[model samples]
Target: MEIFFTILILTLMVSLSGVAARIIPFQIPLPLVQIAMGALLAWPTFGLHVDFDPELFLVLFIPPLLFADGWKTPTSEFLNHGREIIGLALVLVLITVVGIGYLIYWLVPGIPLLAAFALAAVLSPTDAVALSGIVGEGRIPKKIMAILQGEALMNDASGLVSLKFAVAVAMGTMVFTVSGATIEFLKVAIGGLLAGIAICWIYGKSLRLLSRWSGDDPATQTVLLLLLPFASYLIAEHLGVSGILAAVAAGMTITRSGIIRQAPLAMRLRANSVWQMLEFVFNGMVFLLLGLQLPAILETSVTQVEVDPNVDLWMLFVSVVLIYAALMIVRFGWLWTMQLISRRLLTKRPMEFSAYTLRDLLIASFAGVRGAITLAGVLSIPLYLTNGDAFPARYELVFLATGVILFSLLVGVIVLPVLLRGMPRMDKTAQRHELQMARAVMAGSAIESLYKMEERLTADVEENIDADLLKEISSRVIGNLRRRVDGKEDLDRSLLAESLERRFRVTALRAERAEVYHLRATQKISNETMQKLLHDLDLLESLLVEKEE
Candidate 1:
């Protein structure tokens, strides 16, 4: 009951913060506000304390977040930036782990080299949730956004895999050898990829069968989509592989494997809504929980330092600052190098190589704001080794991890907006024009198909169908196509007619819905009857207004 109440209050806090962000006029990021609220509530005066269970956190949060990112990512864009994404996600992660690991060991005394690497691994992945707010709001180039997103998705798997090896070495579960560890990493990564593909294939096939068998039940379809990430994660973890990667792979598979294409429109709509809500709630809770844990983390660090003089809290803080600086420096340098190399090697695609500029490099560097994943990794570190001794500098590790996250968030909040202010805004007019062109092409194809089917339709359904209504609808569609393809004068004339017809139909449907609601409100109609009428109105309105290209 206490736990339930805590969650309820936290959720309320998340909601309040979102509203405050919108209403306050000041451009404070929502997560930053939520984190502050959590910290204040967690103060001693409020007596609020939330202990994070690392394993539970990972299982509950990581899979769905990764899966949603994968599912929503533009596959073509991701592939176009594949080389850069790989460099950032895989190569950059490796560099950070090894480079920062050594730096931490040298700067912070009494921490094992491998344990330091573990800490580095925890801090490595740029959090997608944290980046999305800034990236979405900023006029960052589409290509850069794609690379950042793709890197965020893939790096989580790589970072976690690195953490796994580091922890094993730290816990004495496995002896670290460069060659052996590399082989093991490949095995785990490859195995997880294969497992994810197989799982998604089975899931996709089952989803298609269910859709066919049940005739597109949105509720069932939504539930199945909800379950997929968890199932994929669990299956991969059980196979001793990267569950994060598996979840990612499963999401990508579903998106690309015709599963979503085959689902009913209503089911897709419901599923998207469900996933969006889940992501919002989950991301909010994670950041808030990080804030809630701040007090306890600080206290643990202080106590540990007092008891053992070797555990220097100040040194850990300094190490965090240095490490964060190193992260930015390394990221900027690596990205510049990759761009330079791509320019000379790929003369055919000079535009792709030149797309990244100094400004972009700066934005991308600061965009490496660590969030939930780092928190999860640090918290999940085992308290004791196999010999039952406490993990070395555990509190320090947590403190450093938390410090990096907070610092990174601060950097992102302050720097991103300033950098983005000077960047060019996306051309809304141009985009609308392009969309119009595509819609015109689609309408042309649709008209061709309609003509092809006219004979069969007339022969089979002429008696049942309303031929006049069909002709009017077809005429309006043709007018819409003309409005896009024709001159401004012709467009205005045809558009006015089509617009008036659509307005009349939509207004009638809305009136019907209002009448149904009024009947229900006045207790003149049964709830079931009101619902049925409202549903019909909704379907009618959708048909009248909904446009897809």
Candidate 2:
């Protein structure tokens, strides 16, 4: 209870501080500011004892966060950029592990090669929250942001797998054979994929059943939606499969499987809000844990110094620099390769992805900080061997890893922001114009459809009496619609009409989707089921038109 209150208070304080910082126009990252606050409060003089469990840190914090990320990602964009995402997420992680590990073994003589690789794997994944400010509500093109997000997502799974492999080798549980490890990796990946698909399919079917049988209570439905991700994760873990993958798969399935279709609009809205809140809370907690773990990690490393304390510290410092430099170089090198390949592929067409500019890619490379999962994996490193010889350099490794994290944060949160400050801000005017054009096009199309309907009706009626009143009414309606659609010709002028049209189109799309959802929810319906039903309805409407004709 005391811990819970303390956390709540700290969270509130951070929220307020972030708000205040925006007004004060400070350049510091909000997360760094939050961490500094916690560190200050937890200093020995202040004497706050905040210890978070490693298992809870992994299970409680990671799944929902990852699921939220997957849910919010535009699925279409993810599908489009799937290849580059694979390169960055999977291939780049392997590169970081191999490159950084070899550098560490050479630079720091005593460290085991496998352990160095493990530490490298831990640091490869980027933090979603850290990049939130840089990505800035995804103001960059959806394709670029999707690649960033998908890479981050997949790397979380890959990093965990690599950490497992490294620890197994470090502890001598399994022989390190390239072929054997490759086979095992495939098994784990395939097992995870199958488990996710199965769980999401079953769970989505069950949710649809609930919507059919239960009373139309939006709150209850919202609660059920909230539990879906954690339930999928827990079930997968219980079955010895990858819970993270399962959660993501389940979220994706629910979104795509007509579960969202069957849901009430209010329920869907509430569920989105709930997930957003959960994402924020989990993100804050993960970073706060990162900050709190820093002091202890430092203390442990300080106590582990053996070969001439001064010399040992110097060696560790040098190793960290070498590892960080190696990782940055590899990240940039891969990104440049990707850019060249992409340019060649787009020879016939102009590239649409924003943030591919060399400056942004450099910023991305430096932004590769070890975040919550990295810390959790490092912290979860087994402390005692089966024979009970303390895991070799466990404290030292922790310290070294923590140092790398702090360095990455320092470079990522502190230095990169300053460098990026000079880059061009998002083109607000261009974005507004694009949105305005989209609105005008949609509104004009609707008006043209209505005119066609009016013309067809006039042809069918074949009546000219009382034409004056009809003319007045039609003229009034068309005039109003014309004014709404055509008033925004000057793109430079701020147009409320465009804003209204944009909003209206969005709401109309949502309502149409909601109706389709209702159709899907009504039973074991297929696409043909809805299509046939709609076709019959359309045929009946046409028959009525023919009878009037």
Candidate 3:
């Protein structure tokens, strides 16, 4: 019962955070609001605490979230910006691990090199999810946003893998070598990618067989779809590969597999609705969890600093600020270099780094917000070594990580809007043109298909169907299809007529549903019958309302 109550409270808070974001007079991002609410819950008076188990958290939260991002990612754009993304996700992460690792060791007193690298490894990855939540959608230039998102997707794997090696070396479980690390990285990364693709292939086949056996059971299909990411992660982990990358690969592969498109409309609708709800809940839980940990994390760090004679709280804070600044500087420098290299390579002409606007460079630099993956990765560092000694400077590592994450988020909330404003937005005219073309093609194909369907229906005349009634319905459906492209006055009139018909249909559905309910109330119809009727009405009404919008 206590467990049930805790779940309910967390879910309620997640739901309310959405409402509170809109209700508040000032604009605060949803992630921040949820974090604030969490801190409030953790107040001394409330005394709410949830134990943080790093391993459990990773298995439970990371896979699904990464998978969802991979699923939603536009494959075309991801591929198009492939070079830039690889630079940031793979190369830049390596650079940060080395660069920031040394800086921390040099600047901080008595922190181990291995531990510093682990901290750097975790912080190297940025959170595009938090960025979108902070900046709001459609605000960032589309090109920049695409690259940033791609970076976020790929870097999580690289950063976590690097941390694994660093920790292993620190614990004397594995000896580190340059060549060995490279070979292992390639093996794990490639194996994980293959694992994800293989799993998704199996998923597609399973979906097909399930449909054949059960005949379009939407609930069963959705349940299977929900399991894909976790299956990919666990299987890859068992194989001693990068489970993070596996989850991502599964998501990306499943999207391209086209299984969802082949599924029944009801299944697709239900699956989309369910996934959206789960994504929101999971994301809220992450930020809220971060907030809940804030007070305790701070208290622990303060105590450690107090006991340790080497460092003071103020100096520790200085270290966080310096490290964060170094990250931004390194990030901006790399992005600048990448721009120059890309232009020189693509244009085949010598161009300066200043070819692009400083606004883009600055925006890209500040946009690297350390978020969920960072929190999870840093916390996942083993608390004790093989010899049972506490992991060196564990509290300090956590403190620095949390500090940097918050600093990045706070800086982004303040600075990003200032950089984005007055900058010309990315042109989406090509996208609009493509959408228009797609609609035209769809209308033509639909009309042609309808004609063939009509012929087939008429040819089967053994039953002596009503020919005129069929023709009237076919013409009306064809007229609706023709309104797909926004063009002439006739098209506009057809759309207006369709809109009016949709309203009438909706009204009729509501009336029918009310009648079904009344019959059930009066005992004129069985409860099951009333439910079936209402469900049918709701589905039809859903279509009508969708079209009206």
Best by lDDT: 3
Per-model TM-score, in order, reads 0.91, 0.78, 0.92
By lDDT, is 1 or 2 better? 1
Candidate 2 lDDT by residue in tens digits, 438-502: 75677788778778866766676666536576667677777766764675677655355545555
What are the per-model numbers of colliding residue pairs? 0, 1, 0
- Each prediction's RMSD over C-alphas, in Å, is 3.1, 10.7, 2.9
Predicted candidate 3 versus true structure: per-residue lDDT over 122-218, tens digit per residue: 9999998899889998889876888889889899999999999999999999999999999999999999999999999999999999999999999
What local distance difference test score does each model get?
Answer: 0.83, 0.71, 0.88
In angstroms, give how far residue 505 of model 3 lies from its true place: 5.4
Cα error of candidate 2 at position 20, Å:
5.1
Residue-by-residue lDDT tens digits, candidate 1, 224-324: 88998999999999989889888888877787888888889889878877898898998888888988988888888888889887766677788889988
Index of the highest-TM-score prediction: 3
Score candidate 2 by lDDT. 0.71
Lowest lDDT block of 10, candidate 1: 487-496
Worst 10 residues of 3 by lDDT: 485-494
Give the runs in model 3 whose Cα sits over 4 Å from its true position: 348-356, 423-437, 459-463, 485-526, 540-549
lDDT of 2 at 340: 79
